[model samples]
Target: MRAEEQVEAVVVDDIAERLRDGSREALEEAYARWASLVHTLAVRSLGNHHDAEDVTQQVFVSAWNSRHTLRPDKGTVPGWLVGITRHKVADVHAKRARLARDAQAVAENTLPDESAPPPDDLLATRLVLHDELERLGEPRGTIVRMAFLEDRTHDEIAERLAMPLGTVKSHVRRGLLHLRTRLEEVDRDPS
Candidate 1:
């Protein structure tokens, strides 16, 4: 290998070790190595410097926060970083689209909007809900989603899934309990 290749190999190895050990420094080095490429990708997709910069920062921040979930056996760190950046960019586009849609709805609504204002804390609540749902696994997650997102009653979900009503209720109750605990943890975290 060339001298530069040797240095690159050493850096990858160091990063892999640090990542496995859950070291923040390793996560920082990994971000430093890929931030430029991630930024370029964001710029291309977003077509603006400010949006690209925002996406780039969000990508690294999310990646660092979720670093413990990284699997070295899956792919190279750079590839993983690219995947994270892509997802973040997609999220930015989705949010903008949603905002535009909401604005259009407001323009069209003739009725006095008496619905309670949308929760400002909804994003944090959603992230916590998703994380907790993932931990709850299959039937519990299904039941929770059905009840909350689909507006299905427990009996309705049970009938749809061909599960007993009692089982469905248990899953919903357990899922909510798990979400409550996870939300408490997020609230307690200083960062």
Candidate 2:
């Protein structure tokens, strides 16, 4: 190998060794080197910055907590971190799916028996739309839910959420537009 490349490899190996030996400075160095890689992978997998950031933090914390299990003989530190990131991403997916299912169950139970239930396709569509709404995250998600689902006035949502009227309106408008695009995609794919 080239001398420069060999030097880089040795440096990395030294950092990994220090990290596995329970050195906090090594952990910080590792984060500085690889946090962006982890964060980017998370953003690509999760499709949102908030969850991406959460997953990034979880990955480092997990790596530090489980450092004793890290075996350089098995793989490099980056490879180990990638494996942890994949697991964390899967966890987020499972959590999102579970939340969607719980929301669906609540909606189903609240229906009056005397009323004719919606068709299966309609119910499925509602579930997908609801899931997208949740993916919006934060003030946008809550604002859209309050404004559209609950049929609350903009002023009322503003008062209740303690957000400015303009901000509430903006969120609702943008959130609806995003949902509309998602609905269009669903219509095209129907999967």
Candidate 3:
């Protein structure tokens, strides 16, 4: 290796060691050295500047959070950051795909008519609500789905799920409340 390369490697190793030992400045140094590389990778993969920026931030935060998992003997700091960037990019892609799927689902669920189409905001709102409902999970998601989406009565859901009518009612009530809270949060999130 060239003399300058050797010196740079020594400096990089020092920073990685300090980072693994919990030095915040070392983390900053690492970010300064590689943030652009990370951001470029994200932009190349995601094709959106805002998503790229978000992914870059996510990668650094994840790297700091997972610093102890870094093994300098196994790889350079840039290599580790690249790995994290790949994962973050993949996460953004997966999230996009999931949203697309949710949108398609909403479209499919809507009444089909040549005369009228659902408004964009209505579709977006349904997508958000569907996502929130998924986050609810388990018996609550099932109960709410039956009660609202499938247009089944509480007694019918209780009989179908083999749960007490009161329990079914409770799940639907709480699930709807949680969905409402999540909707409000989405309304407030700006991004």
Candidate 4:
């Protein structure tokens, strides 16, 4: 192998060891090296940057928390991380699929109670909007929840999340647009 490959092997070995021991520093190093790959994988699979970012964080946290499960004798750290990433991406996609299914049911106006009570149109609309907001995921989902569900102002959300005002606003705006598109679809086909 080349000298660079040797160096990388040594580094991966070190990370593997640190990870096994639950060292926080090694977690940071691992994130620095592999977060981009994880994030990109999530984004490509899920097509949502917010969801991708959440998945990347989830991958690292779950890996580090369960680092004891990783065995160097079995595989390289990068390969292990890739496996974790795949599972996390799948989880995010699964959640989205569930949300889509729920939203579709709401859109179709199906209910178990035919005479118990009338379908709450506003509640159904909220459910659809909330479903899309969750698809935004993580900070965006939390941000939208605070702003709408909690009646928080944009500045308040930024302050609470320690995010810039512009970023909070952007998330809210984009999230609203996503919800709008979903609502329009439902509006066009309310069965």
Predictions in order: lDDT: 0.76, 0.84, 0.84, 0.80
Off by over 4 Å in 3: 114-191
Candidate No. with top TM-score: 3
Better model by TM-score, 1 or 2? 2
The stretch of ten residues in a row with the least summed lDDT in candidate 2 is 105-114
What is the C-alpha lDDT profile of model 1 across 85-168, one tens digit per residue? 989888878766754553344324422234754464665665566666667766576677678766789888787666799999
Clash count of each predicted structure? 0, 0, 0, 0
Candidate 3 Cα RMSD after full superposition onto the native fold (Å): 11.1
Q: Write the per-residue lDDT of candidate 4 for residues 102-150, one digit (tens) a residue.
A: 4454434432344665367765766666567668776676666667766
Q: Please list the residue runs of candidate 4 whose C-alpha ends up more than 4 Å from where it truly belongs after superposition.
A: 110-191
- Order the candidates by TM-score, highest first — what do you get? 3, 2, 4, 1
The sequence of per-residue lDDT tens digits that candidate 3 reaches over residues 107-168 is 45643444775686666677787777678776687677777876889998787665799999
Tens-digit lDDT track for model 2 on 31-85? 9999999999999999999999999999999999999988877788888999999
Provide the lowest-lDDT 10-residue window in model 4.
105-114
TM-score for each predicted model, relative to the true structure: 0.52, 0.60, 0.62, 0.59
The lDDT, on a scale of 0 to 1, for candidate 1 is: 0.76
> Could you give me the TM-score of model 3 versus the true structure?
0.62
